[model samples]
Target: AQSVTQPDIHITVSEGASLELRCNYSYGATPYLFWYVQSPGQGLQLLLKYFSGDTLVQGIKGFEAEFKRSQSSFNLRKPSVHWSDAAEYFCAVGRLGGYNKLIFGAGTRLAVHP
Candidate 1:
């Protein structure tokens, strides 16, 4: 089965520091990669996604991800993280020609420090 793994269960970053969240997936072919952010009591919000085309894709809230097929990874990055960016981030994978279902990772909790 195709699955996603977020190596970091939790991460801490300074308010103005850059952030990078690692994600790896297992699949036979190139699959869709997505980064979703969930605030304290809110539902998941799509931060960014990589379906095809450009390897590097930009997302909302200054988030971006690079799809490295060889590495089977799609890592999310931000230039400078804000305190409000503290949230749970999930990496998801979707099949190209399947139903609208997604396989999600355990999620990486991000903590922002002053």
Candidate 2:
């Protein structure tokens, strides 16, 4: 079975500081990797995704991720984080055969200190 792991359960950073959230997956083949952000009391929103093509994929809200096949990782990064960026980050892995099923890691709660 495929699985995802977010090493950091919680991260605190000053506003405007660079941020990187680690995500590693275990899969037989290259799988679809995604980063989703959930604001307080809100549903998850897709931040970025890596399915194929370019290894460095850009997503909404100044966020990006690099798919490193060798590392089995698709880590999310932001050059500069805003106070509004404080939220829960979730890394998910979806099999190539289906999109409906996604195995999510234990979310990383991000706290932006102003």
Clashing residue pairs in all predictions, respectively, total: 0, 0
TM-score per model over all chains: 0.95, 0.94
Question: Model 2 Cα displacement at 78 (Å)?
Answer: 0.2
Per-candidate local distance difference test: 0.93, 0.93
Report the C-alpha lDDT of model 2 over 1-114, residue by residue, as the tens digit: 678999999999999999999999997666889999999999999998888899999999999999999999999999999999999999998866645588999999999999
User: Using TM-score as the measure, which candidate wins?
Assistant: 1
Candidate 1, run of 10 with poorest lDDT: 93-102
- List model 1 lDDT by residue over 4-73, tens digit each: 9999999999999999999999976669889999998999999998988999999999999999998999
Cα error, candidate 1, residue 43 (Å): 0.8
At residue 91, give the lDDT of candidate 2.
Answer: 96
